[model samples]
Target: MEKISSENPSIEKTKFIKSKGLKDKPHNYCPGCGHGIVHRLVAEVVEELGIREKVIAVAPVGCAVFAYDYWNFDVTEAPHGRPPAVATGIKRILPENFVFTYQGDGDLAAIGAAELIHAANRSENITIIFVNNTVYGMTSGQMAPTTLLGQKTLTTPHGREVLRDGYPIKVCELISVLDGARYVARGSVTTPKNVLTTKSYIKKAFLNQIENKGFSIVEILSMCPAGLDMEPLETMEWVDKELIKYFPLGVVKDV
Candidate 1:
């Protein structure tokens, strides 16, 4: 019998190759929106891991709904706020394949809170890439669960009031408190350095899934320039100063 490693030498070579998962079509994300950057990092990580063919990505119904178009892998569309439930079913049925869910803040933290928490508590063998941009981008800038205090959105025209909406949900910290989650980290794509770190975290999350370590999630604090009505550069600066102040950068939990 041919040795598995010898039979797939490209697996080793893939680590040094450029990603082919991204499509040439320009992404529709607003300039400086961190979702695009995180998407690229995830594509690169999947390429480096050489699991593009066997991987299954569940795209959530939000701004990232078109993610399947960019990723060169088997993909399925899940209802709004249902990616975690879909990912749980997919991973449970096909344990050999790598399963992942990509979701926006509104989808994951608001409508899908139960699914996210339950999946993590179950220790499902799945990886989740959670993008927290603080607004409902595809739905016209509604306030999301992660929206900061006093931030105005289409839904909260007068800014989010603490008395009514409360503060932003710190998802990483919340999930880290769960015993079933093997790894939980908060990352960002605000700068090139941060992008690189995000990629490393994604890769580690994928590896942990392959090893059946348990459910893992990487919450990325992304920018939404159009929604925020700020220029691209200014949006990035805001991420560095304002966003980071609320969602401090670092791994919240890894086990």
Candidate 2:
């Protein structure tokens, strides 16, 4: 029996290396959390675009508050629900640099609602990666602004009631109507195909910023197994079957 050599052409050897834009550190995200996947996608995109040196990401005060530890670039912490404001200031001062914000639903659609709206209205040349997991992962399993109508969370144990909870805010659709929002789309990470699609949306957002386009946002529907109090597979199923019903996928606006 002859042993196969690693240099053999028929072996089709493949090398897997960590993204250059990502730090060689373990992420603090919970098991089966989508944050890690999204982080890798962002890191890969930045490295591919060759913009890692000019990137400055504004970290939100949610689950990804310590994003600076994982990303190998300049990252600044912002007050609760104030990433958009902080990113705006950074972009204004360093107009030549690439600026973006990583925010969760609670930070973007709840306390930071005004900031999000005004930023889109002003057509700020920046990219926003909004992660919507229905519930706040860092602060227990509380219902978020984008919580589903029948979702059960720490605050909505009896499932959300439309009369009391109103409706889940659709970030992409709401911002698509603003003239300043040149690009708006929603993506998910429930399956491999969806993951690739989400990456494409994120890359498009970054490209828009590189071309000096106005406000661009990619709202990503993520799975939070711990926050939902469900198994990892169950959370993925919920996102694909139920959540997508309320917030459909695809591009909502592109100008």
Candidate 3:
């Protein structure tokens, strides 16, 4: 890529244009939320892939339910934990459309567990962007299926008990075991390097669907400062020290 030298400063500033996938408007997410970073990454990938026109996002109930308001592209709402089922129907109806689901741990791993499993088992040609922030962000910081053992949440004031609460579900591991799943990976946005790797993972997941390879998913370990009741910097450190221990970052499966 060659740099364009122009006497007109206006044209030089145009070198960095806004991504068409994201809308230029105010966001409703709380301060220190990782959703904003993830949202930008998704939008950048869409722009890079040149599939903005053909993309259709399935937003389910959670912090990301109003994603349509932030994204410039087409989006449809699904019942709580029903994004996989909804994406399946939309993709089946219009195979040309690049379909994806944006869901959180509470919605994806808890309520919509069955739907996601079946979708992967059946090899649906769709992408799933799963954000795992440990605790439920929108609903008063409740314990999510991916919440770490011994971690405290609003619902688990005494900390999550391993004996009583069982173990956190490893979504990437579970989905990768399915023969129909073509790609599955886990990444985090706690660091700059990690953020780049997450973008790579997301790009691959989206490519799998665009190439008609089959089901693909990228589970992102995100930070939720408000939910955790910690400072923004503390939340980042906590993600590195605690969150990544349970959900180790890596490519679980990529066929």
Candidate 4:
């Protein structure tokens, strides 16, 4: 066995492995995908909070399918667009443990819209990490509910027409309007600065959950280079100009 290093220790080494919570497998997300960064942030937060053994992560379908392989905690796979409901069930049964859900835009904003809205409206004691890449990645680059207008996708070859496709759904803003949510923030992982800020927001969401602060969701504006058909570097620019224009950034609401 290779010797472990004490210097620059990671959550996997210091907390997860020590607590015997997560398994060992490299994540399966695509390169340049923000889900990996979000996963690491969640793992770090759970480790830092010393809750690796008491946290349960509900993994949703879509690109985040293998979340259980990455998180060093108890994880259950939820059906597509049902993470909120699944997380609610887990939190309701095990109130003492920390419960969180990892879901993508397609999973959370599309088919799972009702589950997500109801969970938040009910003030379910769960933390949600919502990744909004604007496209249905796992389903072969289809246009998602969060997809920006005039953006070309496999489903919208000429570009998403506003009149036909309607407008892109701003989930953070939508959830913020709900009375049950205690915190609602939109963040990104495109840069070092943004990643740090995103991590802080994620940690805060987890802390809110621990405090029983009701439903908390952090919507992340992530890049899907494969679907966007842009170079990795160019995708960040697209996110800034196009994605942020529609979704914007910052905390939409906190109560």
- lDDT against the true structure, per candidate, is 0.88, 0.93, 0.92, 0.86
Give the local distance difference test score of model 1: 0.88
Error of 2 at 184 (Å): 0.2
Segments of candidate 2 deviating more than 4 angstroms: 1-16
Better of 2 and 4 by TM-score: 2
As for model 1, its CA RMSD to the true structure in angstroms is 7.3
**Per-residue lDDT of candidate 1, residues 1-255 (tens digit):** 358767887856755544687777777777667777888889889888988888999998898998877777788999989999999998888888999999999999999999999999999989999998889888778898998898889989899998999889999999999999999988888887788888888999999998889999998888888877788888889888898999988888888
Which candidate, 2 or 4, would have the higher lDDT against the true structure?
2
The deviation in Å at residue 191 for candidate 1 is 0.9
Query: What's the candidate order when arranged by decreasing lDDT?
Result: 2, 3, 1, 4
Which pairs clash in model 1?
none
> What is the lDDT, from 0 to 100, of the residue 198 in candidate 2?
95
Tens-digit lDDT track of model 3 for 1-255: 135445656766666566778998989998889999999899999999999999999999999988999998999999999999999999999999999999999999999999999999999999999999998999879999888888899999999998889899999999888899999999999998899999999999998888899999999999998898899999999999888887889999988
Per-model TM-score versus the true fold: 0.91, 0.94, 0.93, 0.90
**Cα error, candidate 3, residue 170 (Å):** 0.6
Q: Which ten residues in a row have the lowest lDDT in candidate 1?
A: 10-19
Stretches > 4 Å off in candidate 3: 1-17
